[model samples]
Target: MPHTLRLTVTALVGLVVLAVVGAQAVSVEPAATPSTVVRTSETTRLPAPDAPNVVVFLTDDMRKDDLGYLPHVRNLLMKRGMTFTEAQSPHPLCCPARAALLSGQYAQNNGVHHNSGAYGGWESFDPSSTIATWAEDAGYATAIHGKHLNHFDADAPADPGWTNFDILLEPATDFENFTFFDGDSFNDDYVTTRLDERTVADIDTWAGRRPFMIFANHVAPHIWFPESAKGDGDGDRGGRLPPAEAAYAHALKGITPRAFKDPAFNEADMRDKESIVSGRPKLAPRPLKRLNLARIRSLLSVDEAVAHTVAALERAGELEETYIVLTSDNGYALGEHRFTGKDRLSDEILDVPLVIRGPGIPAGTRSARTVSLIDLTATLAQLMSLTPTMTIDGEHFVPTLRDPEAVGLRDTMLIQTGAKDPSARFPGWAYRGVLTQRYSYARRINNGPTAGFLYDRRQDPHELANLLSDERYRAVRRELERRYRVLADCSGTACNRDFGPLPRPRPAR
Candidate 1:
């Protein structure tokens, strides 16, 4: 089916489903009159006094530096918005990440841990616990356009969420709504442009009705290398521009990050390849056999779409009133550590960009404090003065937007993977790690549990050293092990697993 027509029909189906579901689905009671509730003089600041609109602009499988703003995204956001330098996804996949972001809980709690088709499976979404519900109840016009992981069940249709906008644009790829197949660039039209149009129109049309929240998820820059004949350039689909844009390629060629300039560079450039081929491309060469140009080129459309969305928000007089959060579902690995993409536990694939701009946010502020995407839900709930439905694993980071240097409530960021279902890549590679200011340590869990992929992030940010066996770092290993155990005990992930707590007691000053 043609991408345009398919998305249009899909959008209509979404609307009809939402109308039927929104009326029948249970609704949560709102707080009593505003005057009855006490106002805080100090820290309990709402997200800008004027009920500003909310726009969450999410990308597919984007790396932290894929944006034109590059590493200075924090400062860039600060100038126009706020930035969370340490933002992370609960699990480095699509559906799970989206679910956790929307529900404000970890994969174990939400039950959408892996990609929808994995053995453990997807489709079991908690209807009542979604940000859309809160926003709708708060009298905001909610619209979810791009990807709707919360919209379907077992590849079949389901009410996306109780939002005002019934339009859901599901792609033809497996109906999972999260997976972006490589070499299938032609299929990525709705997310790149169509949704942008829809968002702009929605913002313009509903400018005065009430505050609004639009979730525009774009599927760009995701994996799947096109055939080598296409040449490494952004391929041009039959739209405004063709894929494999040379200008974008040249720009990315200059992106050569300082961190990736080592003598021991891998032959396969970790940077995304832009396919410059005309017409539709084939997908047979596979990873090593195909050219990297297509991947880089693919990202151009996504970047343009982002800029367009930002422009739209600004033109509609909604930018300032809208908390525009630009981020990714998960980070992508161009070619780091011999890995092509995510579904692995690595810093390159796990660390994603988080840019926030809107009312009350300090322009150009950047915080290195560890943060996670799950924090976004809590932050949104707190910002809008809504009660989070359940125990949220993430902390409210709205305070960090204002005071970048402000100390956060949580000391560590926990990543759980490789344990639950054996079907996923790197299965049985259960691991946990912490990114401290000075270093990072990760432990591997196997039949006989032990430390895995331990690294001295300060010296080896590339994650080459497996410092698990070195006697000199025994103390470091023990400390990391203890910390991981403590986090696991408190996290309530999957199960206790009886890994036991740290044997060492806290050091006395």
Candidate 2:
């Protein structure tokens, strides 16, 4: 690992609580920063509600490995909840990932592919039988705040079930001006601040009255640093630079894009990645610094947003009874593999941050079990006993949560990108792959440069090396191709495949 990236992982490990019962152990870096520990004070116990209220903080375009930027979330969610280290957004993109979260099905199964245009976007999703409606039917008050799918209109009728729907219509290009369909306009209220306030207000109204589920969707640390941004990142309108509040404009100033220079960053060779990312020019320093720094600065308020949500739940005396989930729709890339955006099936983009606390979950624990956004929604449905109105392609995590040491039911995770659309960031060819605990293999259509590729993820964490063309990998490639075919077009029960223990580990190259 690069020294700086090592520092980040070390710093995060210092903050993570050591655990019991098969918890993953960490060898702390001697120079790791001392943990900035925080503990939320407990409130006086109140009468238990009929069921646990669920609050999900669904952040946008946040990298799975970037949890260190969220101190409050690290201290509160990680320290108090169970962290899923291998959580993934199998189809890593805004519209597809969000659809998976709502429908408990893969992008192919859900019928939502690209971010916008004919085959994708809001028109493709069937929200009529989503978790919102399912939960609402089960007598829970449901609400969602911030960005919905791409191409959804601010004037669009509220999707079926939610009691409160506050959706951001356009890209968060103007944090101070984007309007929520629910009559919210930001004259001066920043995006994160306003979302936090509205969430707190909802907790205040529904905490003691009924079981509730609030999706506090935040556009923090995403792209389009508002034209109104007036601080260090003001000049960054590159679409990759996130908009931070003025107070946080200088935060994380020291951790520039150079800090994340893993071997994959602007890699020297493109022969192996020729299939999709073959000919991109090397990324420049100025843009990398802007993208990295602004991304970090933009998340400071989101950390505060987490703090606010916890405080509100505590004040309502519902903290102990509510299930709090902190996660992201998908992840973004910052110059890794000479790429600057998402929509690729790289580990950097497919992995998503996932942590949960409340009720029966043990504090400071970890689950090594790999799961996807598709699986997460199914798990939520199972937790609430909501009978899905449609077919669910993923399995629930209740068993894994109930027993962290046991192996999970699903063994393979499908990672695919939709065909390029005129409205999206990635104009690459459609690709599909299957990720196991150790290996990553993918194939592309449209006769892209390198038709297929594979990586031994356990050995090549940065994925700088591809093994598909290797003579020794012939057997493994055949097996992976079979699995990929099974999952790429799979639906419902057929989608959850257990391929036994991982294919026998290959010797170190």
RMSD per model, one decimal: 14.1, 9.2
User: Please, what are the lDDT tens digits per residue for candidate 1 over residues 227-329?
Assistant: 2223221112111211443334333332233224432124233222111111223223243222233444455445444455555565566666778788888
TM-score of each: 0.69, 0.85
Q: Kindly list the per-residue Cα lDDT of model 2 for residues 305-416, writing each as its tens digit.
A: 7766776787678998888998998877788888876778887888889999887887889998888888889888887778899999887888777677756666777888
Model 2, global lDDT: 0.73
Misplaced by over 4 Å in model 1 are 1-49, 69-78, 116-121, 150-157, 160-191, 224-293, 418-429, 489-509
What count of clashes does model 1 give?
38
Worst 10 residues of 2 by lDDT: 33-42
Each model's lDDT comes to 0.54, 0.73
Q: What is the lDDT of residue 222 in candidate 2?
A: 72
